[model samples]
Target: MIFFDRVSKVYPDGSVALQNVTLTIEPKEFVSIVGQSGAGKTTLLKMLLAEEIPTDGQVFFESSDVHDLGKNEMNELRRKIGMVFQDYRLISGKTVYENIAFTMEAAGKTDEEIEQDVPHVLELVDLSSKIWNFPKELSGGEKQRVAIARALVNQPDVLVADEPTGNLDPVNTYDIVQILKRINDIGTTVILTTHNKGIIDSLGKRVIVMEKGKIIRDDKQGKYFI
Candidate 1:
């Protein structure tokens, strides 16, 4: 579960990306964050991962305040939450297998565990066939699937995807969406931020709409009202 209490983000240049926002997301919920280009969606995601600190208010993950955590504690917190982006942030030099294994290694898992975990997640994303291939060789959809596998390999508590389908065609976008939904089916909290109206409308779940830095609507079984 996640909660934000009157959170706001103000940059040094006198701009605010989010203002006085408060929201809650329960466990195992699939939520979509919809907004225009200048909305605060990306800023909100950054705050959740402690990539940026709030100027006011708080961020809580499973009832624990992330800002209150120590260095070692933050590292541990990170293992429980995985993030994906539009770019598919895979290391160019590492093969698909190593890319997925890198996550477990950073979390300090042993080699035996890595050997067990990597194959299963790759299979989960249906990318087991391309395990030894590097990022340069995969298509956009394949890279995204690889990203999903990496995010889920550590058995994260939540998966935060920001514009996950930004670069793909309709078919590839649908493919990624199905994979995300499948991940949610197994109980991980899924937070998706996308501009694709068709995908958002089809989801028919909790949808939060933001504009000019404020959350204007939060609805269950929501429509794409933005």
Candidate 2:
């Protein structure tokens, strides 16, 4: 389980990004976090990855405090989480296969493992036919699929998608949402941060509403209400 024990974050300029926020995410649960810009959604995720230090309290993954981990321990912890972003951060020069393989290689997977797992993840995202295509040759949705495939190649325990469909058309957005649902159904915990009300309403999962860095509401099987 992931826990934020009264976590708060204040920047160097004394701007409060998060204020006394506490949250818990259980394994295999799909949760969506909705808020306007600067509502502290991204800051919350950063704390999970230890990219930002909390001003008070602690963030814990399982039993270990995320902020107190040593370098190697932190690296191991991060290996179990995958991240997707609004802009599909793919290498322009590399083929889809290479892009996914790069992640496995970094984790010290064997060549045989990369060869085996890359195609599996691509198939999961329905991008098997575009394995050799470069990012420039694909559509926006396909690029994001590639990004998702890259993120999942390692089979992370948690998938964090931040505005993944922000750049896609309605059709592409639906496709991506379906893919996310499928990923969740397969048992990986999904934590999504998005402004698309339609997506949020369609999900009908747990909704976490945040305002001014404080969680205002949390509902099981909730809709999009700001």
Candidate 3:
């Protein structure tokens, strides 16, 4: 389970990024968070990853307080979470296979494991045929698929996608959303932050709406309502 207990973040400049926000995300659940820009969506994800420290309260993953972990402990904790972003952060110089393999290598997986798992994830993203292609050679949607494959190669417990389909066309956006749904169906917890109303309405999953750094609404089966 992931829990944010009355968390608040105030930057050094005294800007409030989050204020008294409390949320709970159960395991294997698919949750969507929607709000306008600066509504604290990114800040909330950063807090969970320990990229941003909260001014008050705590963020917990399962039973561990995320901010209280040691260096090695934090690294272990981070391995349980995978992140996908709006920009497909693929390495320009690496092939699709290499991009995914790099993540496994960093996690200390052996060469044999990398060879086996890389193709499996690429297959999951339907990009096996493009394994040798570089990021420059793939289309935007394909690149995002590769990004998703890289994020999932390690099989993290939670997958956080922040505006994942922001740059795609309508057809591509629908494909990306379907891919996200398939990932959730496989029992990986998914936390998605998006502005696409069509995607949100089609999901019919738990939706949490935020504004001014506070949760304004939470619905069991929700649409995109600001």
Candidate 4:
């Protein structure tokens, strides 16, 4: 339930991040975006998150104009979307449980709710035993799993994962992909941007290929071909 209409983004120093890019992501769909660096994938995700304003067009999330929203309204819109990054942005001092609980607390979830949901989500990511572990105490895969759990704690309608497997080994990468697929099967829309061709090929999902700020190919059940 997202739409981009003739969207373009031009930075102040004359760099174009996106040009006439138009795309739509339906509810409960798993879509993968693939391209080299500077292909505007990050800009597209930022536009959806309302972190970047389009230079010449509009972005809509389920019929609401994302760029037109006020500050409070934008925050409300963002609550419906969750983001996971490559770096595993977890708090160094917080334990696995606390990291997720912190996100729930910010979302106004009560202590009881956090207690119940945190363990459930950790179980979903297969990180139940690591509840008391700190970020530095975990492996890269465990850290990424914690990040995924944190992102899912709020149960957002869409999950945007940007290069989530970039830092992990192959086995960990495969595990993360399977976890994402499981999330999608449960009805959350997933938008993934990755450079790994084998991952894209194994996914066998809708693929969008971008080059120099434009979508050059969009294929259903697509491969990793550039």
Candidates' TM-scores?
Answer: 0.98, 0.97, 0.97, 0.97
TM-score of 3: 0.97
Query: What would the per-residue lDDT of candidate 4 be over residues 117-208, giving only the tens digit for each residue?
Result: 99999999999999999999999999999999999999999999999999999999999999999999999999999999989999999999
Worst 10 residues of 4 by lDDT: 71-80
Local accuracy by lDDT, each model: 0.94, 0.93, 0.94, 0.94
**Candidate 1 lDDT, 69-185, residue by residue in tens:** 999999989899888999999999999999989999999999999999899998888889999999999999999999999999999999999999999999999989999999999
Model 3 alpha-carbon drift over 4 Å, by segment = none
Candidate 3 lDDT over residue span 93-202, tens digit each: 99999999988887889999999999999888888999999999999999999999988999999999999999999999998899999999999999999999999999
lDDT tens string, model 2, 1-226?
9999999999899999999999999999999999999999999999999999999989999999999999999988888998888998998989999999988987889999999999999999999999999999999999999999988989999999988998999999999999999989999999999999999999999999999999999999999999
- Model 4 misplaced stretches (Cα beyond 4 Å): none
Q: Supply the TM-score for candidate 4.
A: 0.97
Greater-TM-score candidate between 1 and 3: 1
Residue 37's lDDT in candidate 2: 92
The CA lDDT at 29 in model 3 is 95
